[model samples]
Target: MRKPLPFGISVFVALMLLASQAFAAPKSDLWPMWNQSNEANAASFDHQKWQQILDKYVVVKGQHNLFNYSAVTPSDKALLDQYIVDLTSLDPRNYSKDEQFAYWVNLYNALTVQLILDEYPVKSITKLGGFLSFGPWDDDVTRIAGKKLTLNDIEHRILRPIWNDERIHYAVNCASLGCPNLAQTAFTGENTEELLNEAAKQFTNSDKGAKIDGNTLTLSSIYEWYGVDFGNNEQAVLKAIDVFRDGQKLEGWSGKIKYDYDWDLNQP
Candidate 1:
């Protein structure tokens, strides 16, 4: 009989496999409980409080935006906390799809800012993770409708699976410089679609998003991480982002593909 591997080696191998799987991008699996939406519900969720928070802290610099994390006052932090509490007080499943869309987006962004604030002075959002961890994405951030939810739960489970929109990658900021810019304005039912298109355009045009030099095409790791959402194949992925490209399109020429991401905190 073959001897069993040493306990230390066995544990190490298991941990390594678990770490690899944890870092892989999550699939868009629907959490059916959230799929309920009442199209007849005409009342819109108020996002002005969230907008005020965004307007006060978000500093727009060219195509990118940064948040002044250190400058936030205790009073403002309290207001942010209240905003989250007010959001979860109501059952979003009773609202319309448009209302739900804006609700989730604002909630996600607000929660992300709160997470960074909770651990301010950190070099990267990834540093917020515990031992042998990547980031706080999996940490339970809040409870909505009595269901505990994480950042990953909101993005991958609720938003991505429900909307099935690739533009979500832009709207949900990751509190990192490499991720798409966090919008300065709060997303509303009326403005969500417009903002989504604008974000797609801006990120695609920015050097941090996509840069093509000669026959080499370099893209943000967002594409590589969630390439399936854009379209599994390279050609399809390029086509998906092509419409948003402001410069010479990546049509006609075949080039090498490369992916990179910056994990520095998106703070000023």
Candidate 2:
């Protein structure tokens, strides 16, 4: 015979379950329309403007690369707006997978920057969300090929499901200090793989990503939130981490695994 939890304990457990469900990470659900790609097409989209913006505004300040949101001039802001317009105007499905990968990654990063610029001086990106909303992720930020898309749509529904690359986590920036650094150069088909590898290495080695203390292992909440993408268990997650760790292999640390994240804006 099993003993039932006391009434107060049962209520607390129920509340905890509700809280977990409320903050659960979005799943990778495919949007078939985005899966359409023309492998034979040999055209390259221009990302020069985006590269210019990143080069000028993003600076390496300690371990993380922070954006100079406050330093952006009106002309530069206009340039960024035009760059986004140019990106959304194209139908990415008309390009090959390599090109599409770069396009979506750049678009997602640009849109996130634009969102922050739109609501600048806020301490965090979460401030953009209304009382009922957690963040502006669900808001339609752009239109591509006649279909409006939210950040969540581009990331979870399109990129994650279509590519099935775990490194995609490193490529997309959430405008948060805890997130993987927004690459200094814009992602292009020719350089995405190199950049992805670099970003993964940088993040995994940085304290923001993982820290092994005494006998305990503490990691970014990302690995916890998207555990399935990284392999869905502690050992599997450690294995994924091992791939990018710069130093010695993560060995037998039979201690608690704690996850933490800082939502503070990744801006100077």
Candidate 3:
């Protein structure tokens, strides 16, 4: 009793449905899962080369850690490039969660440092990338497991989502003076927890991380931007910060929270 669609029209509708499905697929489909199985392989990934570079280039000047971007030799740059290539080649899902965690942390930091070195003598990391771009975060700077990824992809999609840990904020440096200092040592599976805790403590204790100015609380803009990632509210964010404050008091502090950040390159 009902008439069917014309053959040509039916075919067109089928194709349209297929196209919609393809377009609607989640972007996460393009990336490998952060963790595949609970069981993990003991296979080792070497980060000695990267550690050497960090040790030689990162300097601790008082409260800030500065990188000698201008002093990086051509040979050192080559080593850095090779290290990234090796890191991106691995299937992170094949490793344990801790190993994978270290992998991403090191990769993110290494890529950031490389970005600065490639465009050294610049005033800020934000100055790199396309005309319409805010920074290199959205640029597909590396390929991992057959998928191209930007710094944003690694930090937001993979690292933050998988770990769901606030300390990660301190782990991934933005190569800016106001950001948490880039550690002088590389992150590894064996030391991942230790390093993350240390980084958080160091940052919270520093003025750039948090400062109480009279009746107002001046905090890093990171808290304002990614406050949800920390605890989803101002009070929760302050509690998270206080965890690393080492008993320092912000007593008589006003509830007013002001945010500030410096985009200047953390250069020596």
* lDDT scores of the candidates, listed in order: 0.88, 0.90, 0.82
**CA lDDT for candidate 3:** 0.82
All candidates: CA RMSD in angstroms?
Answer: 2.7, 4.8, 10.4
lDDT of 1 at 260: 78
Segments of candidate 2 deviating more than 4 angstroms? 1-22
Point out the higher-scoring one by lDDT: 2 or 3: 2
Query: Which lDDT tens digits does candidate 2 get at residues 36-152?
Result: 989999999899999989999998998899999999988999999999999898999999999999999999999999999988888888778655466788898999988999999
- In angstroms, give how far residue 204 of model 3 lies from its true place: 0.4
Q: TM-score for each prediction? A: 0.91, 0.91, 0.86
After superposing candidate 1 on the true structure, give the runs of residues whose Cα lies further than 4 Å from its correct spot: 1-22
Give candidate 3's error at residue 46 in angstroms: 0.8
Q: Which window of 10 residues has the lowest lDDT sum in candidate 2?
A: 15-24
Clashes of each: 0, 0, 0
lDDT of candidate 1 at residue 242, scale 0 to 100:
84
lDDT by residue (1-268, candidate 1, tens digit) is 9999999999899888876665578888889999999999899998888888998999887767989999999999989999999998899999999999999999999998898888887888887867767889889889999999998999999999999999999899988888899998889889998999999998999878888887788899999889999987887888888889878776554879898788888887
Question: Which residue runs does candidate 3 get wrong by more than 4 Å?
Answer: 1-32, 250-252
